[model samples]
Structure formats: structure tokens, C-alpha cells
Target: MTTGTTTGTTTGTTTGTVRSRRLGSTEIVYLALVGILLVAGVLVAVRGGNLFAQGNVSYMLTQTSLLGFVAVGQTLVILCRSLDLSVGYVVALCSLVGATTMAGDPSRVWLGVVAALAVAAAVGLVNGLIIASLNVNPFIATLGTGLIVKGFLDTRFKGPEGEVPFAFQTFGYTRVGPVPVSTIVMLVVAAVAFVLLTRTRAGYHMFAVGGNLDVARLSGVRTSRTLVLAHVLCSLCAGVAGLLIAARFGTGNALVYSYGLDLDSIAAVVLGGTLLFGGRGSVVGTVGGVAILAVLDTAFNVLDVNPFFKDVLRGVIIIAAVALYARRQIDPASRRVRFGTKVSAVRRGGVA
Candidate 1:
């Protein structure tokens, strides 16, 4: 709810009551999450089980961390009116880089982390450079980059390779009072992303570019730099996910690509109510979206739903999300035609 104020020359001031504002998308997402939890709890109770069990909650958080990292990155890229289909490949590749650098050596963990992030950032740089410099369609540019990485993974790596030290493994598995450290890290990353998008110059420029490229360019925004920065940050997040993967698995598995993280990450971003084509969205809503997916996964497990059915349900979710926001693509404020309104015989107010 909000209010409006007006001032008149004769009258000192005037106020008008405005209609209550609708809930924000982020708020709606959390409310939906609560509703889902309540409903899922009831469904689980029917089977003589409790969905709110600490273990179950922790498990969901654990799973959320994995997808959350990539999804956060996806959120940034999508907000910039750009896309990176190569994130899944980056995650998988970074896992290998981190693990292989460690090579079972505990002392080299920092080096491994650096190596992975460097590789991830490099890939992001390439993606940004290609799209921004060449004016390539983001979808096609990212897809091509992803395919290149996929090819490298296929030919150079046959299976899992390298190892992670036990010390690092704890980074992935450690828990504090029902919360996994990895989840905490993910939330921290989200916080950073939120701040970047809401509080910084780069973030403002990103939204401007995504909102209207020509307007932003005319406004003196360094459009290319902004896009490149978004891509770099996006890939960095994926690198973190890779680190988590290596820590958890104790080895880098090239097969991580099969997890379909690229699409899953995108799904989370869109479900958060971000404009599909770009420009308008928030990371807070994205976090809520990730939580929603986590809750659904938990619900599915409690209900003993078949694994295959989960895919079907996920398909329905992605489609529904796209359908929900598709209407926004058309601007209602634009001129509408065929309304039978009388007009002078002129074109755009000029001589006919």
C-alpha cells in the first residue's frame, strides 16, 4: 500500500489515496514457497512423515547450493540481456582444473582454486568479447562457446580425473547447525550479486543496456564493458560451483556436464520472474526461485515420485514460468491500432 500527494496554488497541499500496491515478485515467490512447504508438509504427513525434519531441510539446502551458484550467475547474465550457454561446460571444466591442480596435494588447494577461477574467467572473457565485439546473437555465441568446451571435454578427458584433499573435502560437506557451509557460501554469493546489481555503477549500467541498448549507449554507458563484466562475474560463480563439486566428490568428473546445469540454472532465473528477454529482474527473486525448486525436490522425494516424473514436472515448471512472463514482452503503453478512433488524414501528425 502507498499514497499520493498533490499541491495546488490556492490550497496549501492535497493528498490522494492511492490503491494498494501488489506484492513484489520477490515477496510473491517467498509466499509461494511458504504455501508450498505447508502443502508439501501435509502431503508428507499423509504418509506418516514429517517434511520439516532438520535432515530434510539440510538436504534441500545442500542441493540448493549446487544449483544456486549457477543460477545466480545465470540471473546476472540474463539481466544484462545476454546469455551464456557455456556455464555448464565451465563448471565441469573448472572442476577438472581445480581437481587436477590439487592432484591430491593439500597445500595446492589455493592454487587449484585460482586456476579454476582463471579458467572460468577466461572463458567468460571470450564469451563477452565475441558477443560484444562481433555483435553476435547471445544465444548463438554462448551456444558455440559451450560446444567448443564440450568438444574439448570429449576429446581430452575420457572420465573423472585428479583428486581433492580431505581438508578441501570438508569445505563441501561441513555443516553448522543444520546448515551446510556450501549453502552459506551460496547465500553470500547471492548477497554479493544482489549488491552488485542494486548498489553499483556497473549494475546500473547493466540494467540500462539491457533495458534499451541504444538509449544506454546514447547515455554514455560503456555498454561493452558492462556486458563483459557481467559475463566474467557469471563465470566466476560457475567456478565456485565447480569448486564445490570437486570438494564434494573428491575428484573432477568430466561427466558433470550431464547434470544439465546450464538449462537448470536458466530455469531458476526465469522462475524468479525475471524478464525472459532481459532488463527487469532481481537477485532476491532469484534466490526465492532457487528455494522453490529446492522445496519441490524435497517434496518429490518425500512423496516417492519416480525420477522420470520429476523431469516431466520440471518441464511443466519451466514452460509455466515462460508462459507467465511472456505477456510482458509486449508493451501496453505502445500505440494500439484498429481501435476505431477518429484521426486526421495525416501520417505521424505530418502531411499525408
Candidate 2:
């Protein structure tokens, strides 16, 4: 009986160790980045003297709100081990189409909203179908779709032409108590995403598919459907963001948010420790990542950093984050090799 009890305790300890190890490097990077962000915010606050001023804080929140919308969708896509490069075009095209349809008519804005969502959903479906059915690489498929969307937008509008209704602009500018409505909307979206990922059957299936597509398939999870759903959801998120952008600016500019938002969203998602390969991540971590990016940008502007330098810094952060993840991927194989080499050395030593 004592032997069995001892064995059981040892097994429990082993299981705990395995679970802890699963989050090893990812957790380290996440915590480290958080620390860095906090330190940077402090330094900027001291230097700028307005980092936490109500107005500056509101501006930061507004900026983060826009990027957060895109990051949430990017997290879902990456969680499923897929990419949606079309999101940039999705934002541009949706905003342009919706604004043009509205033509500054407040009463007709709902029609524009419907058109935007429909186009967004259709784009997502095309991405899903082409990648899942045709077995095209997601990167290539989304890229192609993005180009097509961009082409359509270019043909429709040579420049920013349509005006968003004044009533619609309120959604992007209103403040609830002390908070921007955009920020509130982002919080709601993040909360919904968190619950969906943690509580729903579909979310579980998505993670399973991302972790191991073959295993998920064998276990009766519909991997193809999960992939399709992820892309569709991502596009829908972009559509929402596009509409908000149009309302905020009161006009649609195809070139305004075109590509920068995509790169920023991806960078934030990756910085939050979501593996680009998918299968493991947290929406909460993504929230932190988005905040970090926003804070840095805010600080840079306050400090009057050159635009070129800001771009370089962003590129460095993204490359560093990706490299850290890549290192983690190589660790298990390298550990096995080391273990085998050590065992061989022990055998030779014993023989000698």
C-alpha cells in the first residue's frame, strides 16, 4: 500500500512538471516583455510629463482600441495555425465600400453596414474555401485574396471620396464616463473572444486542430471547418474595425490603414506569446501585447523619435519575438540529441 501511494505521488509530480514545462519559454518571453513595457511607460511618463494625463491616456486608449480589434482576430487565426494577410485589404475595402454606399446619408448607414459585413464575410469565405478546399498555403491564399480586394477597392475609388454620417461618427468618438466608446467596444470584443476560446466546444476544437491537425482529425475534430471558421471570424473582425475607422475619420481612405495595421496587429499577437505556428496562446496575453505596442508608439511620438527610427524599432521587436519562438521550437529536438549523446558517452565510459 505504501509503495502504491509513493508511486501515485511521483506520477502526480511528473504530470505537474510536464504541464509546467509546456509553458516554459513562452511564459518567460511574455513576462519579460510585460516588464519592459512597464519600465518604458514609466520612463516616458517622467520625460513627457503627460503620459498619464487624461487627454493623453484617452488618445492612447483610442489608438489601442483600433489595433486591439485587429489583434484579437489575428490571435484567433494564429491560434488555428493560419494567417489572414487579407485583413489589411479587408479593412480598406470594407470602409470604402460602406462609406461610398452611405454617401453621408445617416438614414442609409445601416445599408452600408450590411454591405460591409457581407463583403467581409464573403472575403473570409473565399480565403477559407481556397485554403481548405484547394489546399493552398494560407499565406499565399490570403495574399492573393488581399490583392484582389485591393484591386476592387482601387477600381471603386481612386481617392478618399465618401463621407461617413455624423451619427455614425459618434460610435468612434463617444465617451462612456471617462472611457472612449471604442475602448469599451474593444473590451467587450476581447471578453467575448476570451470566453469563446476558453469555454466553447468550437474553441477547443480550434486549439486541437492547431496543436496537431492529424491527431485532431483522428479524434473526430473537423480540422477543415475549424480553419475555415477561423479565417471567416478574422475577416469579420477586420470589417468591424474598418467601419469604426471610417466613422472616426469621417471618410474612407483606401491608403490610410492599408498595411501598417496588419503588421502591427501581427506583431502585437506574437509579442503576447501566441505561437505563430498556432495551438497555444491567450487572449489576455494578446491584450497586454497590444497595450505594449500602443504605449511604445505613444512614447515615441512624445519623445519626437524620427519616423524612420520608429519603423526600425518595430521591425526589431517583431524579429526578436519571432526568433525567440523559433528557438523554442528547436529546443525539444536539440534536447533529444543531447540526451542521446550523453547516454552514448555513459555507455562508452562504462565499457572503458
Candidate 3:
């Protein structure tokens, strides 16, 4: 009788623990987003402005759209226990490629997009090859790739080049009520990515590889292929961000590499409750992280805070939040202690 009771209790407890661990991290991220917004509202109010004004809301969403795309891709790569540092460079290169191809012609917009993405894909392939085939450390491989792209960009383009047709530019500027069309598109991409991560066999392999590489290999997971695919997807997302820039500015600026998007995307992924070392995260939480950053950006602009100081403040906030998140996830008491002692006692009673 006691054996059955203890077995039932242990199974229920273990299942509960697993479910909580899966959902808890994402909940914490969303709660952080809410906290950020409330604080932003107060700061904006102090400056005699409403944070939720239609204009302000549009601006924040617009910002979220751009970062959200790149961050979504970053989330995928990070989930595989790898990283991409060439995203900013990919953005700059692809933007210029698209703009130069279009050359302000409406009919050529499709051609421009295809050309740009093709280049982005090529860059991603190179990154994947270096990392997966050559066995280069991902950080060093991607960093080198970024530098090479940067050198090529600086040498070839001295200033902004090419123009977006008026129609193409509308994709960046069009809004329905307070929501930008671009934001909608970004959300759709995120939705697709979310499904890919959570509802696919490839996704399971990625999580397994990330959770433990050797174990994944032993289980027949293709670690190299997964890593390569992650980097490619990350670059493709950054390329889309580049296209957005082209649409917004009506031209491609060579200096877009200076925008620091690579780091910012990584920051969003980390802030979204993803482990730096890989495995265990969700794209939904990443959207919340992007929102938090957008809110911060909007709030600082309203407060007239110095841009450099805003960077510092953002860094500090990320550090504290990540520290707390890590603590909760890594605490053994939550996992081991809760199950270990009780299960051991139950087993001992049966043995006795």
C-alpha cells in the first residue's frame, strides 16, 4: 500500500516540477516587462507626457518591430548554445545590396529583396561552414565574419547609396490606428519562429543539443547541422531588419554597422530568460524582452536622458535582471531538495 502511495506521490511531484521549470522562466520575463512599463509610465508622467499617447505607442512598437526580428533569430541561435556576432554587419551589407539593386525603382523591389536575402544567405552559409565544418569557435568565427563584412563595406561604400521607391517605403511607415504594419509583420515572423521552436522535431533536436551536446550526439542528433541552421536563420532575420532600414530611410547607409544591433539582439535574447549557455527558453518571452527595451528607449527619450547614459542604465538593468533569473534557475533547492529528500524517505520506508 505504501509503495503505491509513494510511487504516485513521486511521479506527481516530478511531473509538477518539470512543468513549472518549463513555464516559470517565461512568466518571470513577462512580469519584468510589466514592471518596466509601469515604471516607464511614471517617468513619462513626471515629464508631463503620457507614455501611452498614440504617437508614443507607435514609436515604441516601431522600434520593437526592428529589434524583434533580429532578436528572434538571435534567440534561435542562442538556444542551440551558439551565438552570432555578425548580425549588424549582415544588416548593413544586405541593406546596401537591396537598395543598390532597387535603385529607387518600384518594379525592381522584388529583385532587390531577393538579392539582399541571397547575400544574407550566403553570409550565413559561410558562418555555418566556418563554425560547423571547420570546428571554429562560434564567437570567434562570427566575429571574424563580421569584421570581414565590415572591411568590405567600408572599402566599397563611402556613404549611403540607392533609394527605396515610395511604395516600398510605405511598408515601413504605414500604420493602422496605433499599430504599424511593420510591427504586425514582425509579430507574424515571431509567431512562425515560436511554432518552429516549440512544435517541430528540429526544435527538439536543438533543445537536446543545447542542453547537452555530447548527449545529443549520442542520441543521434545532428549537432553540426543544427548549429549551422541556427546561424543561418539568425542572419536571415538580421537581413530582414536591414530591409526594414532601407524602407524606413529610403536609402542604405553603409555605416549601419555602427548601430550596435548585434549586441542589442543578444541582449534581448538573454533578457527574455534564455540561458547564456544554451537550452531552455521561449520566443514569446523574447518578444516581452524587446518590449521592455522599447519602453526603456521611449521613456529615456521622454525624459531627455543622455543617450550614453541610457546605454549605461540599460546595461545595469540587464545585469541585475539576468543575475536574479540565473539564481532562480540554478538553485538546486528548487529541483533536487524538493524531490530528493521526500523520495528517499518514501523508498526507505518501503525497503524497511
Candidate 4:
């Protein structure tokens, strides 16, 4: 009986240790944020605040679904140490084209969607090709492409609104019970992205390339191809996001989101604990970041805070989070030694 008890204790200890190790620093940070948010949410609820009301929650989720999709793609691109500034414009153009093509044609909704996706993919391919072939910086390459695409969209849709089919719009408004379909789609996308990044060789190569381009190339990794593929995926994500937005609005607007989405996507990626330097992040983090942002927005609306102030708060939060992450990455031993030396210097000065 004593032997069995000892064995059970040993197994329990082993399980605890494994569980502890499985929760990495990023996961810990995420958990902390979640806890804080939960507490805040509860407080807001107890205050009889409208933000915690069911209607607000549903509205927030609906809004988040649109930008959350783009943010997911942005996280992947940023993970590879690259940025795609053109995502907003890509989304705008795709949305416009999709809506225009499906205008009043319920039977051809799928065709329009396929065509829009093809265009998005083609645009992404072009962005990848130019960046890879010319060795141009990704920012400049994608920005230029984005401008061209935006211009084309403006010319195509000049001064007129394009209607989307009623059937397609149903996806934006329809819910399975209380949950929005867009939210479900975002969740699925997040799940797929998480699996790809964590479980696939392609995901591994993406990290390798981002972590060290020269080393990855030397190790027979296709650095260029990986980057190109990353861009393609990023743009594809933007395209899907655009379609969802169009469906929600039931019309295609030229301005789409007025470039706010670019900042929002970056904010979501950084807030999710994905290092700005790349090669270390998860789709789960991105999703959490999105949720945090959405919750904050809902809170702000409930409190009736100025819209512009949210941007200021967001910037400050991003800077502080990145700084904290950087500090954590420093070696503990090195930090301790530095602290010791500082103490020694102070003691000597006092003696003198």
C-alpha cells in the first residue's frame, strides 16, 4: 500500500512538471491578459453596465469578425519578419469586385467569389514575384502594388455603389443561435492557421527563413519561395476578409475601411505576444489579441470614450507590451550579475 501511494505521488509530480513546462512565457502572458480581462469584464457586468449586456457582446463579435480575419493573415506575415501594408487596399478591391460581380445575381454569387479570390491570389503572386526578383523591401513592394490595385478599383467603380446579392449578405447577418457566422468562420480560420504553424513542415520553414535568412538559405531551405508563399497567403486572407465585409454591408464602398484596418491588423498581431522581430508566435495568440481588442473597443463604446483616444491607448499598450517582452528575453543570470555590479558600485561610493 505504501509503495502504491509513493508511485501515485511520483506520477502526480511528473504530470505537474510537464504541465508547467508546456505553458511557455507567451502562454503565461496570454493567461495573465485573459485573467485581467475577465476580472474587468465581471466588474463591468456588476456595475450594471451596458457593455456586459448580451446585445453589446453580440455586436462586438460581429464587428470583430471583419477585421479579425485580416489580422490573422497579418500575424502570419509579421511572423515571417515581413509586413504587408497593402492588405487594406487588397481587401477593399476584392470586396468591391466581389460585390459588383454578384450584384443582383443570386445564382452567380459563387462565381463572383471564385473570381475575386483568383484576383486576390494573382495580386499576391505579383507582390511576391516583384519582392523576390528585385530583392526589394517587402514594405515598398507591397505598398506599390496596393496603390495600383486601389487606383484600379477606384477607376472601375467610379462614383457608383455596387450591390451584393441578398444570398451572400445572409452570411453576414445570419447566426447559428446567438453566434455570428463570421465569428465561426474566423474561429475556423484561426484553428487552421494554428495547426499549419505548429504542426506542418511548411510552417517550420517559414520560421527558419524569418529567424535567419542567410542560415536558412545555407541549410538548403528555400527562403525566397517561403517568403513568396507567405505573401500569397497574407493577401488571400485579406481577400477573404474583404468578401466578408462586403457581405455585411451589402454594398461595396470605395473607401472600405479608410485604411484603419492596416493599423488594426498590426495592433492585433503585436498585442497577441507575437514578437515584432518574427519567428515566434502562434495563431492562438493572434486570436486572443483580437478578442482583447474587441473587448476593449466594446468597453470604450459602453463608456462613451472618444474614438481617437482608443488609438492612443492602443499605441501605448503595444509599446509597453513589446518592451516587457524584450526585457523578459534577457538572460536572468546576466541581469543578476548586472544588478550585483550596480549594488557593489553603490556600496563603494557610500564607503568613500
Tell me the whole-model lDDT of each prediction, alpha carbons only.
0.86, 0.83, 0.89, 0.79
**Highest lDDT scorer:** 3
**Could you give candidate 4's per-residue lDDT for residues 1-352 as a string of tens digits?**
4444465456556655655565554576578567756866776766677565668878878867887888888887787888888888888888887888887689879977887788888888888788777888888998899888878877877743667888899878888876899999988988888888889877888888778888988999887788888888888888898888789888776787475787788888887878777888877887777777787777777766788997787678778767877776765544554565566556656666
Which 10 successive residues of model 3 have the least lDDT summed? 329-338
| Cα-based TM-score, every candidate | 0.88, 0.85, 0.92, 0.85
Error of 4 at 345 (Å): 29
lDDT of 2 by residue, 1-352 (tens): 4444465456556655765667654466568656866776687777856666677677778888988988998889899899888898899888887888899999989999999889998999899999888999999999999888778777877898688999999989999765899889888999999999999998998899889989999999988899898888888889988988899889887985455788788888998888888898878888878887877787788778899998899888778877877777765644654565566556656666
In terms of lDDT, model 2 sits at 0.83
Q: In model 2, which runs have C-alpha deviations exceeding 4 angstroms?
A: 1-34, 45-48, 257-259, 324-352
Q: Could you tell me the TM-score of candidate 3?
A: 0.92
**Mind giving the per-residue lDDT tens digits that candidate 3 earns over 1-352?**
5665677577668866776666476788888888889988988888789999998999999999999989999999899988899999999998999999999999999999999998988888899889889989989999999999999999999999999899889889999999999999999999999999989988888889889999999999999898888888888998999999999999998898898889998889888888888988889989988988999999898889999999999999899879988777675545665576577677778777
How many clashes show up in model 1? 0
Each candidate structure's count of clashing pairs: 0, 0, 0, 0
The TM-score, computed over Cα atoms with residue i paired to residue i, of candidate 2 is 0.85
Candidate 1 at 199: error in angstroms? 0.9
Off by over 4 Å in 3: 1-23, 332-352
* Candidate 1 lDDT over residue span 1-352, tens digit each: 0111121211221111111233556776788788988988999999999898998999899989999999999988898899989999999999999999999999999999999999999999999999899999989998999899999999999999999999999989999989999999999999999898899999899899889988999999989998998899999999999999999999998889889899888888888888767799999888888888898999899889999999899789778767766754553322222121113213324542
